[model samples]
Target: MCNTFPAVSQVDTGASQHRIESAAALGTLVSSTASYLTVLLSSPAHASASESLSRHHAQVLWDLADIDARTAGLLARILQPFLSIGILLMIIRIVLSWYPQIPGDKLPWSVVVKPTEPVLGPTRRVIQPVGGVDISPIIWVALLSFINEILLGPQGILNLLQRKIDIS
Candidate 1:
């Protein structure tokens, strides 16, 4: 039997190299995220912030890295949709608050207060009367926006977590 070796074309060789590099990078990211999560979970005070927030940030990065889409990542993915729901709730509340003529006890509008009342109740007490106008919705919107920035913004917690992971 004669042994023969097939010639490797430049394109094939380049593609293989690219795949190898991508795998290496992915491996590094996975390890880094795992290590960081371990430390963060083991020591609650390691990161100075709300425990849940810290966990969420870790989860976000872990998901983005696509190392594993298991528990943490799955939970982290909920934050975006949760925030979207929150914004929608706030908008409905704001609209209803704006037009007193609209009967809120009716269907559709009835559900708006259920989720938003808890938040608006406390906020209304804090914000002084704006010429008899309830500005609590605006305040809530601002607060939610701020939260979104902190948790989901480009230079937000995810980046911070990634940097820390990269450093270690």
Candidate 2:
């Protein structure tokens, strides 16, 4: 007996097309990232960080933060206070958070909010607040403080580099 039903054509779900597109996008992303890393690993003068740092006998602090010793002192001075100021702003934001009635757009509050929002906005999305309270400000404070201690503290990376520059 012959079948009476119409033969349905296979549907093109575009899975193969999607996969090809996805693979191409991923390859492009990888290539882009590799190029970026290549530049970052290399110095402003196009020298490797390891290669540049090797010239110095003082081997305590070696990182991507400073590739040239000429700028180490300036970097330390600027970065130390930058981190401190970040922590201070976060603290002020934390205090501002305590007073919910204060409008964020007003003077003083706006000054604090404008600077800290860029940081806190992304942080809140990544880490949800505990209980009913928002803790991003506090978290940022801790992060800045920790960074300050790590890169600018006594025996810190940049501080050591700064010392190295001072000695030479």
Candidate 3:
């Protein structure tokens, strides 16, 4: 008996092609809209009065410029909340370090110290106390601050990634 079906079926090829074309069209539309909005919103008069707004809009334009930049921007946005939490926890830990007798089960205060021990323990071991003061919390705050800068600051990894994406 001879085989009737071909190795590669042509079924749905037109549909797939149409889907691909639609996706390309949608992408182009989105990019064009972003560029238009950037130009419309980035007038010097508006930007000069609101530096934060200007920076935010500029970053959005940068992210929309390429896939890698967009991914980096998205990652940075997702990580921002966690970074805020980390900073808050570090601040609490620093306060806790000032008091040696606050029990972990202490009401109201436990909320601050308990959540931060896991983060502080390793640093405490590595950093050691400075002049009889536990400096681990401060160290962690500094480290987390540094990490926040690397990942999300204006001249951060995302910006570097955007530059690389543009270069390529």
TM-score for each model: 0.52, 0.59, 0.53
Whole-model Cα lDDT of every candidate shown, in order: 0.58, 0.60, 0.61
Clash pairs, candidate 3, are none
Query: Residue 58 lDDT in model 3?
Result: 55
Residue 145's C-alpha lDDT in candidate 2?
85
lDDT tens digits, residue span 111-131, model 1: 887788888888888886598
Question: What shift in Å separates residue 78 of candidate 2 from its native position after superposition?
Answer: 1.6
Number of clashing pairs per prediction, in order: 0, 0, 0
Two-way lDDT contest, 1 vs 2, winner: 2
Order the numbered candidates by TM-score, best leading: 2, 3, 1
Off by over 4 Å in 1: 1-75, 159-168
Clash pairs detected, candidate 1: none
Tens digit of per-residue lDDT, candidate 2, span 1-168: 111111100111232211112333334434544454465466465445555344321221211332344455566777877888898899999888878899999997898899889889999999997986789999988888888888778978767755554222
lDDT of 3 by residue, 1-168 (tens): 111111111111332121112334336545654554566567666535466445545544432433355556566778899888989888887777787787867878778777888877887788788899988878878988999998788888766765563332
Candidate 2 segments exceeding 4 Å error = 1-69, 165-168
Which wins on TM-score, candidate 1 or candidate 3?
A: 3
TM-score winner, 2 or 3: 2
lDDT minimum window of 10 residues, candidate 3: 1-10
Task: Assess candidate 1 and give its TM-score to the true structure.
Answer: 0.52
